[model samples]
Target: RTVTLYAPASGIVLEKKVMQGQAITAGEELYTIADLSDVWVDAPLREADAGVVATGTSAILDFNSYPGHPFSGRVSYVYPTLGEQSRTVRARITVPNPNRLLKPGMYATVRLNTSAQSALAVPQSAVVQTGDRAIVFIDVGSGRLVPRAVTVGRSGSDYVEVLTGLKGGDRVVTSAQFLIDSESNLGEAMGAMSGMGTSPQGKK
Candidate 1:
């Protein structure tokens, strides 16, 4: 009996080797198949940046073909090996390509957001980042702006998660944070401290 081989997955026919009724072997070259349900962006992250990339980390993928649109995904796989020349590890983020807008060869930009899981969060403008350290200007009593060191986590478009420096009720300056940041000398003051700092009363 003649056997008919079926296409593996749904995809546009890239190239067909044999026409209908042509003799084909069991292991003969068949049509290539691909699905857009799961797509990956080979984001090369520096060795330093690899620390922030872990499993389940959220990532935003943007494609030039579809401008002004972002597809949400997660860090599904992190390569164990790093590029010899670039010294950058390949972080594979899985994106949902429902409409097949993202093709295999299409180039795209990936934004990896890695930060605090659950903690007091504030506007992104409220925190000042200095290399490895993060500082925030807390509004103390009597129109006072106090500088405190905090461990920051994933930053959203408008907000950032405070890992340790803040609590639920603390009031922080959201707008014009640069003004307070400049005046407070926060970098020098909080730079010496550990992850979290305390108030004058010694309360976190």
Candidate 2:
């Protein structure tokens, strides 16, 4: 006697649990199949940025396999629980894979486009994080740069919200800020050393 087996759904075989003449048990697992017509991309959202994400939020995904090429998707679902260690919420995005280019286990970078709002913001490159505080160099006339500590709020891909320590139309150093900061510190140290060399009567 002979028996024939058939798959319930039409899909590419993802896993093969049994080989020819290897299995002879009833109700045993045989294979795993997955349809590639559509796929889900899991994205982790920062806790601070999760509030703006919704079901219909548009998302752009870039895959390592296809550099510079982006795939469009939308937020389909958001997980209820936040990652304990990562401190991020998982959001599921639905993307069509007609060409089957987006394979499983491929790494992707996701950018979500939420509703736009007005706020004081600066390019991310303008700010430097130092331990517990954030600092930005302000161009205070005559090519002099002053470092000012700032309070920051929610952040995006290219910019961060400036909650305090800056005003509208202020010029900030966006590049080579570390060099400027180093020079400023050096000048301060040299001035302090020079002052120590002087006596109370203004004589060295």
Candidate 3:
């Protein structure tokens, strides 16, 4: 006598637990199958960008295997918890893979499009982080580059939003800012040292 078993759903067999003539139990483990019609891509959203991404947001994914080919998807779910180490939120994007080209565990670059608003922004290279505060070099005329402290907000790939300390027409030093900033700090130190050398006139 021969008995035939059928899978509950149609899918590709991912794992085979029982071999030929090996399983005899009535309810033994058999095979693991997965439907590859659609796949979920988990993307990490920066803490600063958590507020902008939500359900139904459009996402674009690029895989290294298929260069120049982008896969479009929508934000299906956003995990409530944030990654402690990465300081990012997990957003699940549902992408259609009819051809089954996108496989599990594949690395991809995710890009999300959020609502656009007008704000003062500058090139990311223009901002210099000095441990605690963010600084930008401003062209203050007469070939002077003044370091101004700024409050930063959302950041994109190329530009970062400046909440304060900058105006619309402000010119910022994008390149060679680290060298300029170092010189400015040294000049300030020299000025302070010179002031220290001068004793009080009445006391001296």
Candidate 4:
């Protein structure tokens, strides 16, 4: 009787774990096969940004090794849950490798485009985080940076989405906000305490 070994899938052999003609158990590692015809790129998108991304969306990937060469891909899957550690949603993109140039463990940059509605956005520098709440300083005429709380959504490396508490044509302080935020907090505390020192009948 003759027994033949067959690979589950057709692909190039990456590594040979077992020696030729070596005795192997029923469930044992044999070889590592890689199908380089198509590649999958898994990336993490913020929960807010994930809402705008979907399957079938177009993605452009740029590899560090290959300059000026942009590979086109499409979204294959969007993970259901936002993991606790990173608070990010996973996106799986599929790209074709006709020339078999793309290899495993290569660094890549992915830009995704979807059919989602445009969101009201602001520069990331304009927003500050105070625990769960996000704060933005608005210019209420005459160089006043009024610290106001806002609801934020999906964001990129540079910009963020404003879900609520902001509107169009609003001047926001992007630079020197940290110093202003500290002063704003101090002023608010002073105002609340000033009323306490004054008597009800206007006597200090």
Identify the leading candidate in terms of lDDT. Answer: 3
How does each model score on TM-score? 0.53, 0.66, 0.76, 0.82
Location of the lowest summed lDDT over 10 successive residues in candidate 1: 195-204
lDDT of 4 by residue, 1-204 (tens): 458989999998888999877888997979999999999999899877877888999999999989899999999999898899998999999999989999988989999987767778889987877568787766665534456679998777898889998888888767524533455443552343345321111111
Candidate maximizing TM-score: 4
Which ranges of candidate 3 are over 4 A from the true structure?
1-6, 23-29, 143-145, 179-204
Q: List the residue pairs that clash in candidate 4.
A: none
Superpose all Cα atoms of candidate 4 onto the true structure and report the RMSD in Å to 1 decimal: 5.9
lDDT of 1: 0.73
Model 1 per-residue lDDT tens digits across residues 24-124: 77789867666667887888887656777998999998888888998899998999998999978998888888877778888888888878444568888
Query: Any runs in candidate 2 off by more than 4 Å, and if so which?
Result: 24-27, 125-151, 163-204
**TM-score for predicted model 3 compared with the true structure:** 0.76
Over the stretch 1-204, how does candidate 2's per-residue lDDT look in tens digits?
568889899988889898787846888889989998889999998887888898989999999999999999999999999999998999999999998888888999998998898788899888877678787767666655566678987797788989899999898877534443565453442243244321111111
Better of 1 and 4 by TM-score: 4
Q: Model 2: what TM-score?
A: 0.66
lDDT against the true structure, per candidate, is: 0.73, 0.78, 0.79, 0.78
Model 2 CA lDDT for position 202: 12
